[model samples]
Target chain A: MNKLLKNSLRFVLFLLVQTLILNQIEIGFGIQLMIYPLFIMLLSFDTGVLSLLAISFTLGICIDAFSNTFGLHTSSLLVFSFLRPVIFKLFDSREGYDLLLEPTVLNMGNGWFIKSFGSLLLIHHFWFYLLEMFKLNDMGYVLQKTVYSLPLSFFLCVLLQYLFVNKQYTK
Target chain B: MRNFIAFIKHFRNVLIFALLQGIALSLYFTFVQFPRTQYLTTAASIQGSILEARNGITKHFNLSKNNVRLQKENIELLEELPKSFIKLEGKLVKIDDTLHRQQYEYIPGIIINSTHSKRENYFTLNIGSSQGIKRGMGVFSTNGIVGVIHNTSEHYAVIKTCLTKKLNTSIMLEKTGQQGFLEWDGVNARKGSMTGVSNDLKIKKWAKVVTRGGGGIFPRGLPVGKISRVEVVEGESLWDLTMIFAEDFRKVQNVYIIKNLLLDEQRDIEKQTDYEDQE
Candidate 1:
């Protein structure tokens, strides 16, 4: 499959799965499972930041439209995509990244993937739930939601990568 | 000019990020209460139809429960029929019917999609303007009050349900006649608070609450909920009251959209009063 076509298909798939399936799962204790940030994290490292931001914004808006959340999802996804490149650079290895590699766990080892994706997902969830409940007195609830939802979302995103991505190690 | 161009080039990514972020956040805040259009909401054709199709599949999951509620309502109506009552033989009584006129009509609708946990939640209904549904019309189930029509397209409509903030429905306690506006605290779906009731009056536990019908959106005396707790406010002379909603919004599928036949008359009179006051 062409790279562009494959990614577009993945984009539509992620949107449907997130809105239709994951959004409906109402586990108590604010344990929301968000996998769309994985879509931002899995984009190739060389992808332009502007395009990345646009994609996240579009994806977020689509999800928001479905869920009646206005633009809350778009704002949080935009922040996550905007910081993706900076975080990647911060955690970049000394030997530098290879051009042929993608950001999947197969290409980038588990340790690097875990650190970068973990921090990005943390920021995304915190921003999402914080702005969602935007009351000062409810800061405790926001933190509680972020803390509980992060591990489940992180696990699901990792599980998604394993199930979907073929492990063809280049190095 | 070259130095300025260099500066622009230096922070191009940041500028674009800020621009996009501004647009997104503006959209978020602007439409949080009133939706400017139906395009970005589930009332849009594509999303509405998709949800309707999904609802077609999942609706049956709650079929048995809905059936029981419907059956119970049917029994209540059945028991109210003239055939069920016996007439006494003593005297003939003439009842006058010309003093009253019907003012409200109900249109049936199915909830295609809904969310209970969001700070501002809206439910999508399968019926819309095509079925004579309009903005500001009241929506309620057989059990209790639901919401008001927020927006509509040709074939679908979105309801700003009781779960949201600022969608106040004027309600009153059944026993004491203490009226207050309904408000949701963004906490539990089953629970909501009523504000503006004076604290001097004693309220009973589990007293019924019903719609007041002052706004003309809903008819008089629709069942809303039962008061579970009532407490006095600290600084203000008002009651801090919470009620358990009668309708479980999460499982609610069938609802009726209220159409006020005399709404235009009411609005026209009110508008003239406002105009006269201005003059």
Candidate 2:
């Protein structure tokens, strides 16, 4: 499949899965599952930060329209995409990244993926809850929500890669 | 000029990030405080139709449960009909009186989407301006009050339910007659709090709370919930009361949009007093 067409199709699929499926499941303690950030992470390595911001904005707006969170998702997703390159740089292997390989668990080794994605997910989740509650008085609750939701969302994102990403990258 | 161009090329990413972040945060805050448009909300045309299609499939998951609740409401209405009662006192004859008039109208709608876990929860209704639904109209199920209509498109409307942060509907305790504004703490869906009522009044557990109708949005005596706990506010004379909502927001599919016929008249009269005070 053409890369552009495949990525666009993934975009729509992630949007639907996040808005229709994940947003509806309300496990208490403010634990919201967000795997759409994985969609931003899965984009091609050479995609420019400007274009990445634009794509995240569009994806975030679509999800926002469905879930009625206004621009809450958009703001958080922009932060995710903006920090993606910085995190990639920090987690760069001794040989550096191969431009041909996408950022998936199969393409990147387990340790590299875990350390980078884990920190990224933490920042993303914390920023989301902070802006969401938006009250300094509710700092404890916001931290609690971020901590509880981070593991669930991260696990879901990792599981999603195993289920859908092309295993041919391993070879 | 060359240095500025180089600067722009160097820090374009950060600048653009800031610009987009500013936009998103502004949009979020403005919409949260005051919903001005329906374009980005589910009330928009494309989103509304898509969610309606989705609801077409998932609405059936709770079909039997919703039907039972509807059936129970129907039986209650059926029992109240004149035909259900015997003419036990013909001497106290029924007569048409010139003094009374209908002041409220109800339009039925079904909720297509709802969320209780968010800081401010809004439900999308199947009815909208096409069905005479407008912003500020009160929405409620047969069991209890829901929320006010926040935004409306041609065929869809969004209700800012009681689960939201600032859904301050005026309410009064059934037994004590003390009134307060309703509030939600964004943590629990089944529980809510009321503010502004002083601590001097004795409030019993399980006492009923109903709408006071002071704002003319909801009619008087609509069921709100029952008081479960009452604690005095720290260093204040007000009572921090907690109540369990009567309506289960998660399963509320069917609802009625209230249309107050005398709202315009009431507003006009109230405006006169404000105008007088201004002068």
Best by TM-score: 2
User: For model 1, how does the per-residue alpha-carbon lDDT over A1-171 read when each residue is reduced to its tens digit?
Assistant: 677897899999999998878877778675778898988887877799989998998999899889888889999999999999899899988988775556998778789989999999999988988788878899988888889899999888888888889865565
DockQ of 2: 0.83
**Candidate 1 local lDDT, B1-279, one digit each (tens):** 999999999999999989988988888888876789998899899999988888899899999999998899899999998678787864765577788998999898999898876778799999889899898999999989999999899999999999987666899988778899999877788988899999888888999999999889998899989999989999999999999998889889999999899999999999999999999
* Model 1 ranges with Cα > 4 A deviation: B89-96
List clashing residue pairs in candidate 1.
Answer: none
Q: Model 2: clashing residue pairs? A: none
Per-residue lDDT tens digits for candidate 2, residues A21-85, read: 89899899889999999999888788889999999999998999999999999999999999999
- List where candidate 2 sits over 4 angstroms from the true fold: A168-171, B90-93
Q: What's the i-RMS of each model?
A: 1.3, 0.8
Docking class of 1: medium
